[model samples]
Target: MNNTTQNKPINGNSLIEIGYPENEILGIALKINKKRTGFTKAEMLDKYAQVMSSPQDFTEDKIFKSLAEAFINGIHLPKIDEEIIPLNENPKEFKIYGIEKIEDGALNQMKIAMQLPVTVAGALMPDAHQGYGLPIGGVLATKNAIIPYGVGVDIGCRMALSIYDLPASHYFEHHDILKETLMKNTKFGAGHGFHGKYKAEHHVLDDSKFETNSFINNLKDKAWSQLGSSGGGNHFVEFGLIDFKEDDKKLNIKKGSYLALLTHSGSRGFGATIAGHYTKIAKDICKLPYNAKNLAYLDLDSEAGQEYWLAMNLAGEYASACHEIIHQKITKELGAEVLAKIENHHNFAWKEIYNNEEVIVHRKGATPASKDVMGIIPGSMTAPGFLVRGNGEENSINSASHGAGRQMSRTQAIKSLSQNKINDYLNDFGITLIGSGKDEAPMAYKDIHEVMNAQQDLVDVVATFTPKMVRMADDGSKED
Candidate 1:
């Protein structure tokens, strides 16, 4: 399988985390043909079931745990080094600048990264948290090839910003009725979408892409249905107040401040499933047993790769549609008009010229802070977020932080903060509060100020926003 793929399947610099031994796992897994592989899917399933039936899987878990430590960079392993979170994740050779936590899973990912290499330079932004393979707040740059998993299953998953003319106080005046209307018009959590709500027009085919397949055909339905829905986990939409009135004394626009609505989500499960399917194809084609499973990628020039690129872009469009649907819902309930909306996807790949090389730039939790790039910089529910533009700082590859980095994990947030505290914070803003489980409370993330300060070399802030009523998945619903 690897023979048919590009010759350059390995990346030395990116292989650091999966260095030495972890590639063996991929080698072994690939050697066993899916049909003849000793650990067939059936056998693997049986093993998983037995392990679940008792605790045998714990042994594999422990083995994987140890192997993960060896492979993943910025990961914490039991028998590994002391409690030191580096100011820069890859201090040597790589330019990653921050490492807030290095847990076991992250280590495992490093071990897995040995074979699949990334060209996109990374900074491991302060909000770094574990996701499929790439860390939630992690950043990466790649050349020639684009890793599907790096952008994640939720291709084009990102944050959105909508500015408003009304002040935060205006929401308070319409409180109860607005909340009722929002709930009725908008739906949150999994499987939340409006079936057949949009009109899908076929785009003229790009040069390398092929005719639409059944899978692609189904996507049309998915998009229409998933419109206006907010997927579970950390995905959310909030009404916030910008506190930037001349030296922080203003609540009005004279302070260059504005009331904003902020939200975080992705292309929903439709994108996730497509990403998963192709990621597997990339892995199988690579056949070399990469150190990081999620680092699977496709060359931009190949037929399959072109198909993925087209699909990925389409998914981004769908994600934007989802947000637009939400904005409409909010407008209907609040009876307000939107001043402007600035939306960008931090996940997904871009075609750009880096170092005079025409390359595909895959930004995984990082926004392109190119000289003209305009994007949002969101904070926690109670902190300040911003809308910034890139000054074309090459050191950070013209990229900036995604949001206020996370200081604590979801479990930690739930343990440390109380419901009353959450309630108090929301009340102080006098904004409508809605769905958000304890996992995504404001305390779960890091301070936005420090994160921005550390990244001053990357981008310039155009505006800052403070939270009014931040809504996320509620305590009673599914949390990711």
Candidate 2:
């Protein structure tokens, strides 16, 4: 009588046909109108049609799925604090050294990191460059939480320098043995490991954490397999010469050139898997504002936070073991005695006192420069690395740049650099590079001298290292 055929509404049969349970439909109804209850099929259909025609409706299918998911996940009305906090109109102040040298994108990422609700303080190292979430050389102090990406994909990525009693000439005299040792003792590239009887042996495999933590326990075999290998992308195992200054007390060696084995690596696949797994969980639990998308944090008191803490610390130990095995194997293969070892983990989190309060300090690509702390900061293949002692300045958060940070991205390097030019540059430096790609060429990095000068207040250089022979991953693959 009133063109009723044209005015038919959505029926319960339609909802059933679409596979929504009654409770899901009811939840959607309540979401549309909290007072909605005790509705007949016809009444529900009328309300659905009314809401669908209103401005609130955009996609009917999405609304249905969201309502269904809410029921499945037990999500009801959001709690009072569920809303994302507004971007800090006034981010807490932080320190930045070598500001002029830092890229704008890196600066922006640091600013975003400063806006995180848990961030207590922040600092940018001289080697600052853009990376995922946190800038490469940025340091952040947070309250009772840790950002996984803040520690980086290569968890416990570090620099290890082992000074030997042998003179620098030993490397040149027995170059063949050094070459064979490097080739035999270390495996580079992603997912590559020793076969049969050649696997590295380390005590890190005996840690109880591997048995206790499921995430870490799952990675035990892989971790064991990659124990002594140098995972790629800026990671390297090199034979170098260290010239100690007379005033250097930490090394306490004669002020002359000596053969040193310098290695740059991390926790290998074990770290990468842990980072990826936990970061996703952090995102699910913490609804961060758009600005802090992948920079989410897990509360320290929460179960996940504790688990990650255990895994991360274990990974740090494993990384140290990796360096230990590499250095030990190489030194043993050459029959060289070690004089001193200087090592530090850059990609890690530490429980430290900051501003008279305990905080978790995350250094992505920055070194911990707590007063008199020794760390190794490497340069490009053709450049020099440094053995430095931390000055423990408060403003810079007792941190220094990890290395002469990349001046250009890998894509830029691969696109711009010529293989012939890279070869010529290596030849000029008299450096024999093995198994490296164009992306890690000398031109891709900043001048190490300038970077050291910029962070003079953060650390004091104790010795200088010159790379004589270096090995990295082969080309045509991404290692990190």
Best-fitting candidate, scored by TM-score: 2
Clash number for candidate 2: 0
Position 384, candidate 2: lDDT? 92
Alpha-carbon RMSD, each predicted model: 10.8, 14.8
CA displacement after TM-score superposition, residue 27 of candidate 1 (Å): 22
TM, every model = 0.72, 0.82
Q: For residues 1-480, could you state the per-residue lDDT of candidate 1 as single tens digits? A: 122331222332212211222344334323322333233232232222222111211333422333332333322222233332122234223344454443455434433442245454544555555565666555555567767777765678777777777776765675666556556655665544454434322231121222346666555555555666677656778767665435321212345555567778887756765675566566555433323444656787787677778778877777777777777667766666676677877787777777786666666677778896777888776677887777887666677777775566554666678989887876775545577767677777777777787777777776777766656655332222
Cα lDDT, all candidates: 0.58, 0.77
Report clashes for each candidate as comma-separated counts. Answer: 36, 0
Look at candidate 2 and tell me the lDDT of residue 440. Answer: 90
Q: Pick the candidate with the highest lDDT.
A: 2
Per-residue alpha-carbon lDDT of candidate 2 for residues 1-480, written as tens digits (9 for 90 to 100):
123532344444444322223455445644544333443333343334322211121223333334534433433333466766566667788899888889998899899999888899999998998776788899999999989878877789889888998998998998988888888888887655555577778878998888756656867877887888877678899999998767455556878899999999888767766776677667667767665755878999999898889888889999999999988888888787888988898889999999899999999999999998998898889999998889999998899999999887666787789999999999999998888888799999999889998888999888899999999988433433
The clash number for model 1 is 36
